[model samples]
Target: MAFRNGTDSWVVVMFFMIVVILFPLGVGPEPDILNKISSGVIWVAALLSAMLSMDRLFHVDYDDGSLELLVLHPQPLEFIVLAKVLAHWLTTGLPLIIVSPLLAIFLNMDISSYFVLIITLFLGTPTLSLIGSIGAALILGARRSGALLSLIILPLFIPVLIFGVSAVEASILGVSSKPQLLILGGLFLLSSALCPIASAASLRQAIE
Candidate 1:
């Protein structure tokens, strides 16, 4: 299903790149200034990019009635929600990670921080998807659900964003990023364990 919506994925990737590109243009082309803000800029763009496609996570299935079938399946709805979240991460989050190196270069991020940026993104983006899933499910059938989904999920995304940027910033400053990375990992595990179940419950409520 995600593959079928390839255009959305492309739009997200383009948006991520464009946002990063805009910072250089808007903030002036000074490499020093860009370097200072690179981690935050990239992370913010990734967060918004992730949110861009979030509404589609379950909306298509819900609209087409596949969500109802999946909910009614003998298999646990949580597993179904988890699978969809994984697909969402693959389509949306994975692209951000893949394209981030070039964006990092564009932002004048230090070479040493590149690895930490990738690591943080890898750890953080799935958590974004998982947590976003709950909001996506909650906003099902809602009018202007895209805005509502943003409102519901943006606060939840802040922790991931903070730690993700902090990890990269630490590396740039020649400090250890392990603490932030560990926290990001913990967030991923926590969201992985909890978000699916929460999303599944919301999905049930939505369908009713």
Candidate 2:
């Protein structure tokens, strides 16, 4: 209980501090500049946060030999991989939604856009977690796994990053954001269905 609490607390605190620093640094300081760049700023922070947080997914278990046991379990490896991805979404992606409003404020976002920001994050970050799992699973045994993981996953992130930021920008422009959001949601559904199976296959290769 203590360990779980400590880990959860640390994760939340780290995410908070990292976003607080990153949004401003990426977007710049002028109020007008921030407003103009806020959509991009928030999306970039989400990307960085998602990337950083994913490295720890299998790392914790891999270090402790639990990853090996997970591979060896009688239950299908696909299900196990799905469970881990779900847990990752719960911990990291869920928090991204919760914290995006504050980050939006820092980016000088209009107050009305806050709900759309949260909704977009909710729709988008799961895809990040899911796609990231593939890279994380593939690079599990590499010497520079972290860097390799980022390289492999970064390209895959482009579509989500594009539509996610577009949704916010559309909202701010008082235009319909639904088309972009629907695209983002479709990407999430596709990734959620496929990424775990791919991650499980990659885990098999890594374990072998």
Predicted structure with the largest lDDT when compared to the true one = 1
lDDT of 2 by residue, 67-89 (tens): 88888999998888778877877
Runs with alpha carbons beyond 4 Å of true place in candidate 2: 1-28
| TM-score attained by model 2 | 0.89
Alpha-carbon lDDT of model 2: 0.80
| Colliding pairs, model 2 | none
- Which residue pairs does candidate 1 place in steric collision? none
Residue 8, candidate 2: how far off, in angstroms? Answer: 6.1
**Top candidate when judged by TM-score against the true structure:** 1
